[model samples]
Target: MNASVLPYREESLCFGPESRLIATLTLPGDHPDSALPAALTGSAELPPPHPHLHQASRTSAHPAAAGRAPQRRPPGLILLNAGMLPRIGPHRLNVELARTAAAQGVSAIRFDLPGLGDSGFTSSRLSHDEQTRAAIEDAMTLLSRTKHAPDRFLIAGLCSGADAGFQMARDDSRIVGLYMMEPYYFPNRFSNMFRTLRRLREYGMRRSVIRILQKSRFTRRHDPAADSAPVPQAAPEEGVRAAPTPQHFAEDLRSLLGRGVQIKLIYANTLMGHWDMRHHHRHIFSKLGHAPHFDVELVPHTDHVFTRVEARRHLIRGMAAWLRRIETQQHASAA
Candidate 1:
């Protein structure tokens, strides 16, 4: 398989002189002529724009629009948080995902947080919350000034970036949809641990396990022969945490569902109970119960980064299918 270098345009937009963000608008150079028709005809459901969704008083002038049914490019702005270390999983994943979205007639823009990337300082230098909020504002401000106000906007992130995306959608209803790859929540781990303890009686050697745990001195050595039983560990993914109490994650979920934003979250199932444990799937699903506006899908046999070629391919295909479904639903509703 050949990996093509994505082509993009660079522009700087500032919410404030000292608080500017930089982004690269990238797309595949050799998009097929067939994609336009597919994009327009692919009848899929689209979550309605939030009341706060904004658009510029302008129209697009791209070639595809000239011969189509008022085709408007879907523009997405990706914001990365500076609070975490830069890694390949998210950076490469976004690059590839953005390129794929663009090939399918979507426009993607990714920028560094205020103090991260090419912008300035480390996340520790400033308030993390403030930086995330400012990043969202910057992304939104950029979307408003696009050649054509983005007909659709999707926000995505990884780890701290995912946290930032969640906060952004909560704060700004303009973000119609959210695609969080893996959101890292630290406190969720202890919750899972306690829950596991409650089920200890199911295992015959529960007393022995507790004894071992109580004696921290004996825990220093890893005894493969200690027991064939399983132990709770952090999720093995790049950025994930153990499950949190349903009540604890309720605020974030409410923030998302309260604004009526549809969420499409994808993660590796194997990451559960490990370093990247994320057991809020049921909680999120229950919170969104009976809400026709939301959809969720999980991809198995893939790691957080989607390093496997097949995993990446599946991820892209799933995204395309979801987008098409949304479009179909929107047209049918109008008719």
Candidate 2:
């Protein structure tokens, strides 16, 4: 397929009260009509139906005879922002991913959440959770109106975007697959500290000491409770909440898995300080212990945002392969 010919449309989608999100919707082109087979030499004639056979039975055997419509494809992809990055993604990763995926026959929509990118804030105040949920619901509603009217959805995001995607999959059954890059998985303090010490040892005593001093100074400067003087705790924001504990994350993962949601978790090497390594996923979700539904990949020599050219290429390829796998699985199940 000449990908350049694929059609795409850009529009402003309204979601929450007084909020408008900028989005681009891409559609896969229809397959070229097959030339009628040159009249086959002596093609076998079809057998006549039984005298009492119902019209429905005949139609079922030959759908075209009754003008039965072709089955609709599943929902298209949804690309989200990473942290405060716009829908273009860091280094235009989201745009690249969407276009490449579209070339592969997976339609996609990349959009900005309210108050982020080009989107406007809601009329009324909404917490982070509320806003995330509402924005996704709105995106789904918009996609549902497309010609495909896709009911099942796949969501991909990086960092905080990944966090929101995970939360959405947990809450919504319609979400069938999630692509998460450097998602916010809480670290096990003891294991994390051990790994940090091991990493420091590799850096030699001199550099490690300097790093420790810098870390200590940073912690002391930021620790309001470290001072002898009594200080009042800052109040939490109206809609913002504390990060979820490992237990909460584990439970959520288990729930999504039980619901047959396919998940891909890619962690950049920079996250080793917190996530330690791929095996640490077991530490976080001991009960789920390497469930098949969860596909985890560790990107070596990469920063959280995959800023390097090689790293970006690696990310794109990895995501494309995973998306293809999910597509195959969906088709198999549907069949």
Q: Which stretches of candidate 2 lie over 4 Å from their true place?
A: 1-16, 29-72, 190-242, 271-275, 289-291
User: How well does candidate 2 match the true structure in TM-score terms?
Assistant: 0.72
Candidate 2 lDDT, 1-335, residue by residue in tens? 33223333233343434536667665544432111111321223222222221111101221132474665466568899887889999999998787666556666788888778888776757786787787787777666655445677889999878888888888788898888888865555466677677678689889988878887856555655567777566665433434577677778878888888888888887735434664465656467766667877778877889998898898888777877787777678778
Local distance difference test, each candidate: 0.54, 0.68
lDDT of 1 by residue, 1-335 (tens): 12222232223333322444445544323323424533333233322222321221123222234555754445454535424443123436666666556556555666666555565553344565675675556555555554434645777666456666776676666676777665543335466675456346445476758765877766677877767877667655334444445565666666677666667666654333332333455544565566555655556766666667887677667666755655665566557
TM-score of each: 0.61, 0.72
